[model samples]
Target: MMTNILIVDDDIHILNLLTIHLSKDGYQVFQAKDGVEALDLLQEKSCQLAVVDVMMPYLDGFELTKKIREQYNIPVILLTAKNQIEDKEQGYAAGTDDYLVKPFEPKELSFRIKALLRRYDSRADDSVVRIGHTTIDKKSYEVQTGSRTILLPLKEFELLYFLMSNPLQVFSRDRLIEQVWGFDFSGDERTVDVHIKRIRERFSTLTDDFQIKTVRGVGYSLEAKRS
Candidate 1:
């Protein structure tokens, strides 16, 4: 299948430039003038990735990224003119999988896009992993235990799936963040801790088959318990 890429920018020149390059690279390009238009385009078309500009008229890139993160499980690249550290932090915090400063080479953007797509593609394998009585379904992004079915946020689900996939193996916060999020993740290790805490709290009463154990000064592991 040909990959679909959505480019959202108020700057017509930038949009055209990106569309030309991405299309040349064999991607089916979709164009949107602003974040609002981008969301509308998403509703009608299933894009594998989105390239969003930071300064849009209707909805800004950060807000658009947040909405996309909540509604979809696709990778997003934030395009901005500012190369400030604060802007990069805001972009990452807003859930962008990658960030690109304006005046960047089209080849660099293509490379970053390919890298993000590759990471996501690796995690898209259709497999069901079970630890004790709990089952983690990567295909459906659902968790099943006994008579209950649980749905978790995307990041939490990915984190749990990674740990459960390698049951009993300890993974440090840095490792987990790099594996679950991208290697370019700008957030600290606290991000992983927060996700782990939420996962534990959510499944505290849902199942007794598995536990996420913290390895002091290390990281976490999913230990299968006898039910």
Candidate 2:
């Protein structure tokens, strides 16, 4: 199946540029001028991935991303000129999958989109894994804390889902490095910390043991469900 992608940006040039390039790669492209419109379209129709801009009119990308986390596990890439570490943090905190600093190449954007879509596809499964109050339905790309839902971005949700599926299993950061981010990733274990912190923060209100635990000298593990 041809993958669907939604590009939400206020800049006509960026939108047009990305759409043109993505379509050539055989993605079913959808466009939105701002966050609100992007969301209305999302409610109406779904996409496999979304590319959002930071400085939109009515709703900013950050706000839109937080809202998107509420319902969808679709990958989102933030397109913006803001390159500061703080700005990237805000985007990641809001649950953006990837960040593209402005003045980027259309080819680069195409590559990033492809990477995200492939990552999403590799983790596809319907098996549901539960740990405490949290339940992850992999097939549906759904995350739940009992009945209350905690909105998570694509990477964070996938990270949590994998760990939960293999509870109480000690995985070295290197092993997690291999599975969660894939062997193609050359980054250090620090990337693991970032995603783990995000998961724990979201489930902080749900349960104490819903936490992803740090094993002191070892790596990490999700607490298993109590039957």
Candidate 3:
């Protein structure tokens, strides 16, 4: 199947440039002027990935990313003009799978897109991981325990899924950040703690089959309690 890519940006030059390059690379490109138009396009077409610009008239990239996370299981790459750490943090917190500063090489964007697509594709092949009665479905980006289904934000879900996949293996904050957020992540170790805390809070009352154990001065591990 040919890969479908959606590029959301208000800049006509960027749209045309990316469209030309991505098409040359054998990808089917979809263009939208803003988040509103992006969502409208999404409703009618199925895209494997999205590249969103930060600055838009009707809706911004962060907001669009959040909405896409809520409704779709595809990966998102956020494009921004600012190279500030805070803006990168905001983009990650908003659920972007990758980030690129503007005036970037189209080849670099292609490389990142290919990497993300491979990651998502590999996970989708055998995406379901389980501990005791709890289940994490990477394909659907959801968690289930008994009859209760939990929908976590993209980062939180990815964090939990990573830990559960390697149950009983300790991983440091840096490792988790690299594996989950990618090597380019600029956030501090505290970001891992925050996501781990949220995952614990979310699943604390949901199950007894497993628990995320913190190793002092080391890192964390998901230990299976029952099975």
Candidate 4:
């Protein structure tokens, strides 16, 4: 399937350049000039990835990314003129999956976007991600605990993969927002709570206890073990 991409930039020239390149690469493109319009469209449609400019009037890319992380798990590439390490760190903190300094070639950006999206595309087709007896099926969208096989919604499955991939690392909610949702998402920290709740409920029937850990105010971690 041709992936859907959303590009948000205030510069008409930059937006047009990206659109042309992305379309040539066989992606369906969507464009917006500001954060509010980007987030509004994101909420109403399905998208695989987003490329957002860091500087924009009203809401900047950092805030937009934080919002996206709250409700969606799409790849986000942040485009910024600020070259400082702290700025990059802030972008990562807000949930940008990748960062591109401004004045970059559109072709280069398209390549990076494809590479990022390919990781997700690969995971979606796998039958299982095995960690001991626990089985996570990417194709059927299910996670197995003991004898019970729990069905997973798309976001929940991606969450599981991210947690499982990282093992014991303590991820803050802000980081989870970035990794699971895109940087341009405008939801709140509590949104993560809701999804985690639903995921656990599905696992509950499969086992009296299972393996998604909460580190109090820190956030969540996934471990491969009996719960």
Among residues 3 or more apart in sequence or in different chains, the pairs in candidate 3 whose N, CA or C atoms overlap within 3 Å are: none
lDDT on C-alpha atoms for all candidate structures: 0.90, 0.81, 0.92, 0.83
**Could you list the CA RMSD of all candidates, in the order they appear?**
8.0, 11.8, 8.8, 6.4
Over 1-227, each residue of candidate 2 has an lDDT whose tens digit, in order, gives: 77888899988887788888888999888899999899999988869999999999999999998788667878889988878999998987777889999888889888888898877776555387766666788767788776776657877877887787667787778767655676468789999989888777777777764557899878998776456
Would you estimate the TM-scores of all the predictions? Answer: 0.65, 0.61, 0.65, 0.65
- lDDT by residue for model 1 (71-133), tens: 788999999999999999888778788999888999999999999899778667648887777
lDDT of 4: 0.83
Cα-based lDDT at residue 57, candidate 3: 91
Worst 10 contiguous positions by lDDT, candidate 3: 175-184
Q: What is the lDDT of candidate 2?
A: 0.81
lDDT of 4 by residue, 102-163 (tens): 87888889889989998767756555677666677666777776777777778888787677
The Cα RMSD in angstroms, rounded to one decimal, for candidate 2 relative to the true structure is 11.8
User: Among these predicted structures, which one has the highest lDDT?
Assistant: 3
